[model samples]
Target: MRALTVTVRDASTGPVVEIAGDLDYETAPRLRQAVEGLALEPGTLLVLDLARLELCDSSGITAFIVARNRAIAAQAEVALTAVPAHTARVLRVVGLDQIFNLYPDADSAALPSAVQPPPTANNR
Candidate 1:
């Protein structure tokens, strides 16, 4: 199994966590920990750059869910970028495709308008 590597970098939108290698049961916690350490402000977009991600198993998907929940709790948003085809297939099968925003790349996902805040009642 490929060892997991999680790296975090800051962008104008928020933190971008680039995950590489295998994201399996053993290495899933590394992702969760990396996400937990991020400072997500309201409206901040947490982009998970998966371009280098070699593999993702069920536990990895669960870690993604955990990250999403944390982002929501902070009133922030989450996006997945460059998802591998196999992993994307599994995510779609589980209906998570409807939950997390999917982006083609980190640059696109980090754009200022990538994730807009929901319209408030006053905006209606």
Candidate 2:
């Protein structure tokens, strides 16, 4: 199985975590440790980007729930971005799709609105 890697960075709204590789029993703790270290502010949006995530086992699903709880305890919001179709299907089947806000990409998740504002007439 591929090893998991989580890269953390700041976005316009809050912190963005890019998760790559497999998230199984062996590597799930790494994600939990990384997330637990984040200093999330109240109302901040914590985006977890899984664009490159190769796999997510039961432990990984549990880790996601833990992350959601952590965000809630901090009074912060959480979103999952670029979830793989297979992963999304699993979450849907388990009804987690309703628990998490999902976006097509990190950029979309970081936006104040799903779409950008229109330019003013002055632009002409």
Candidate 3:
């Protein structure tokens, strides 16, 4: 099986994680670590640019969910950009597509400048 590689970059919106190769059981932890290490500030939007993503399994999907939760816990927003058709289909089937904001590309996701408001006590 091909090894999965995750490349992370900073963008104006927030941190942009660029995923490549296959995301599976062996590499899902790496993806999780990369995401967990991010210093997500309140009101920032983290974008996962998946244009280079090659493959994903159940573990990969779980990792994505974990990332989303992390962002929420940080009082930040998370978005997915450039999702491949296969990955998109999987996310949609699992109802995760509704959980994340989807963008056509990194630029589109970055164009938005509105800052997310801090989490209210009730929301937390």
Candidate 4:
């Protein structure tokens, strides 16, 4: 069995997790751990770049869902980018395509600028 490797990189959107190799029962936990470890801020958007992902199974799909939930819990958003055709089909079949924000690339999913108004509780 080929070893699975997930590389993480910081992007303007948020943390970009690049997954490669086979994502199965044995390697899904690592992917979940990597996503959970990131302390994302509210409104931040996490982009999962799956262009390099070679394979995936039910466990792998579950890991992706876990990552999405984690991001939402932190008040951040999560997007799937460059998902392989096979995986995309699986997601569609499972109705996850509607649940996750899908992007063609990382650049397309870049986070928008913050638009919160300045605090005015104690202005002089």
Candidate 5:
């Protein structure tokens, strides 16, 4: 089985966690532990970069939920970036896509400057 590795770094939005490798039964707890250890703040976004995440099972999904709950408890937000197509499909099918904010990449997720401003009446 592929191993799972989670690395956390600070970002403009908040703390960005880059997750690689498999997120299965064996590795889900590791991710949960890592996220539980974070000190999230109000209004900050906890961005999870899943660009290289190999696989995610039920346990992994649970871990994601745990992370979200922890962030919410801290009054922070949560987002998922660079989600693989298969993973996206699973999230969509399970209705999790609606629950989590998704981004094209970590940069787009963490940088508010990259966000598109709402179009004005002139543009509409």
Candidate 6:
């Protein structure tokens, strides 16, 4: 099994978490902890860069859900970038593809449109 590595960096939009190695039952908590520790603000986007992710099982998927839930609780948004083909397939199979905003790369996902703006009187 590959050693799981979860690293976080600040981005203009929000935090960009780069998850490498295996994201399975063993290392899922690490991700949970990393996400829980983030100070997410409303109208910001939390981007998960999965370009180096080698594996992702059900537990890993659950971790992603947990991150999403946390983001929602903060009134922020979460997105997945550079998702591996296999993991992407599993996410699609479970219908999470509709839940997360998928981006081709971290740069694109961190754009202003990544997280929806607060409803304004004109938009309402």
State the C-alpha lDDT per candidate.
0.88, 0.85, 0.82, 0.81, 0.83, 0.88
- TM-score (C-alpha) between model 5 and the true structure: 0.89
Selected candidate, larger TM-score, 2 vs 3: 2
TM-scores for the candidates: 0.91, 0.90, 0.88, 0.86, 0.89, 0.91
Choose 2 or 4, whichever is better by lDDT: 2
Best by lDDT: 6
- Tens digits of lDDT, candidate 1, 1-124: 7889999999888999999999999999999999999999998999999999998999999999999999999999998999889988998888888788888888988877676522210112
RMSD of each: 4.6, 7.1, 5.2, 8.7, 4.8, 4.9
Clash number for candidate 6: 0
lDDT per residue, candidate 3, 1-124, as tens digits? 7777888888887899988889999999999999999999998888888888889899989998999999999999888888899999998787777677777887777775424322210122
8-113 in candidate 5: lDDT tens per residue? 9998778898999999998999999899989898988888899999999989889999999999899998888888988888988898887787888878766674
Candidate 6 Cα outliers beyond 4 Å, as residue runs: 116-124
In angstroms, how far off is 104's CA in candidate 2?
Answer: 0.3
- Indicate the residue-level lDDT of 48 in model 5: 88
The lowest-lDDT stretch of 10 consecutive residues in candidate 5 is: 115-124
Report the lDDT tens digits of candidate 4 across residue range 38-112: 979997888788888898999999999999999889998888888899999999888788778777777767735
Model 3 misplaced stretches (Cα beyond 4 Å): 113-124
Q: How many residue pairs clash in each candidate?
A: 0, 0, 0, 0, 0, 0
Better of 3 and 5 by lDDT: 5
Q: Give the Cα error of residue 86 in candidate 4, in Å.
A: 0.5
Runs in model 1 lying further than 4 Å from the true structure:
116-124
